[model samples]
Target: MFFSAESGQINHANGTQYFRGLEVKEFSEETATGMMDSLLYAPCDYVITQSYTCMSREEAKKAIKRTRRLLMSADDDAVSQRLDLDVALDLLTSGKIAYGKHHFSIMVYSPSLESLVADTNEISNALNNIGITPVPAEISLSAAYMAQLPGNYNLRPRKGELSSQNFVELAALHNFYPGKRDKAPGGCDGFTAHPVRRWLLYQPA
Candidate 1:
């Protein structure tokens, strides 16, 4: 079962639907486990879970700025660029934005969707200022759909795992496990990282 964003209708499919501009990749159980492990092991910056609500442009911009600063301060340039901070900023400022009650999460490290009905000119201008190509609604919708896949996991490292300070200071931090450690059957230590520190874990009723 899948959905067709182009037609704006849910469609049933025996196989995975390959929509253009959407990233849909099949992974084996081993691969899926690895993906989840990588995310689970990484450090995190911030974990925010909030009720569904609309934010004023000012509030949104402030949030965006904070996220941008955090990303930039990180050691990984890819992390700073991959989240598309500019697009999120534009969406927040687009006005009248609302997320549904069932799922309106804004995982900082995950890919998200902006309203298709937002003003293209405004979004384009915002992207242009950041030197990012404007992504069309179709692509954005497809990306959002991909994120909903059960096999797909968007993970970020927990705070204190990766220091935003200078390289020297970051290296000086202790290498102790951030969470409780469990002993595996083979006498190996197992660590469980909490990426969703404050987020709700939604499940079907």
Candidate 2:
């Protein structure tokens, strides 16, 4: 009933190196709740959701410049040496570039306090594995959950400073593209994080 982690859709057996998505030792009872999102409201005993929002161009530019200036004047010599900041600054100064920041929020819900706590802890740890620090939505839990819905972008609880490039890398958007490229000699077909398992295959009783 479980997927075999070893078999992946990406067939880069030699040259390509795939980014390690997550490194959790085990899945939770609530693991299925977070991964699947549906348009219809099929209320469950628990719900855990997260959202990432892209900032406006003007706001992002100003924020980027302000952060750069602060780093430029800071006494720490290492802050300016960070490659992420340099790339962001170059995008702004080099010429016209599409760049922005993203605000994000995560919410975990359960009918009982115990499951809620466990699910939140599991999800938070998973997020941390991929370099995201989950901050509890103190006074903004409702807003954070609501923000997961479409047209509720304004409900994001915190101002996310993550760059657009970083967001793209984190999201599945940059994973792999399909087209004539797939038809090309070395190109791959659309891939999935989950691949079929022998245990799940049909067998005669």
Candidate 3:
């Protein structure tokens, strides 16, 4: 048995299991590559990397390009409503996308609609630019949890025109939006992409 997070391995043979804490984390990338490479020479009947695939590399690229055009031209109102989508996509390209045996969840916390929408395209473009094909199904935390868990969240517009300030307020709840108190000159004065997730444990009624 092996634990990826800590990179520990357990060896069991001869009716006994030996436990050892090897310096596996430092060698994880190389070890993983070596193991997978061995599969090229001989097939092994085992699972690898928990297996996450959303769309083919080609599909993700197409989806991202289409979405990016929409973002650059979308109205402030539309941007405010769809930002969570963008963050989720960015995470996918960052290799943060995860899936289970059956269901998949795209997790982002407190995302403004605009950032979510825009960042998704950015992530898609980033992935395509890097040549890693990802197939990710999309899900929104707010829509999924609103009825069960809504909070005192509100947005305020900066300059009363651009949606930047409004989007920042919406994103803070998720820890993805950076504070507007200070920013670099000539840099985007609005929110940037940060992605997060929350876990819910519901009791049966």
Top candidate (TM-score): 2
- Candidate 2 lDDT, 38-140, residue by residue in tens: 2112222233333455566676677777776777778557653455566766775665455543554444444344555565566666565544455555455
RMSD of each: 20.0, 15.0, 24.6
Q: What is the TM-score of each candidate against the true structure?
A: 0.23, 0.53, 0.20
Identify the superior model by TM-score, candidate 2 or candidate 3: 2
Model 2 TM-score? 0.53
Whole-model Cα lDDT of every candidate shown, in order: 0.33, 0.45, 0.30
Give the higher-lDDT candidate: 1 or 2: 2
lDDT of 3: 0.30
- Please write out the lDDT profile of model 3 over residues 1-205, one tens digit for every residue: 4322212234456332211111101111111112223222211111111112245434554555566667767743566434644654565456655221111112221123344344444443433343323333212222222212324122110111112222232223222233334354544444433222222222222
lDDT winner, 2 or 3: 2
Off by over 4 Å in 1: 1-50, 79-83, 96-205
Task: Give per-residue CA lDDT, model 1, range 1-205, as digits (tens).
Answer: 3334531223346422223221112112111112222222233221122122234456556666776887778855766353656655555456524222111111222111233223233333433443334333253443354444554333211111111111222123233343322443443233333454333222212
Would you list the clashing residue pairs of candidate 2? none
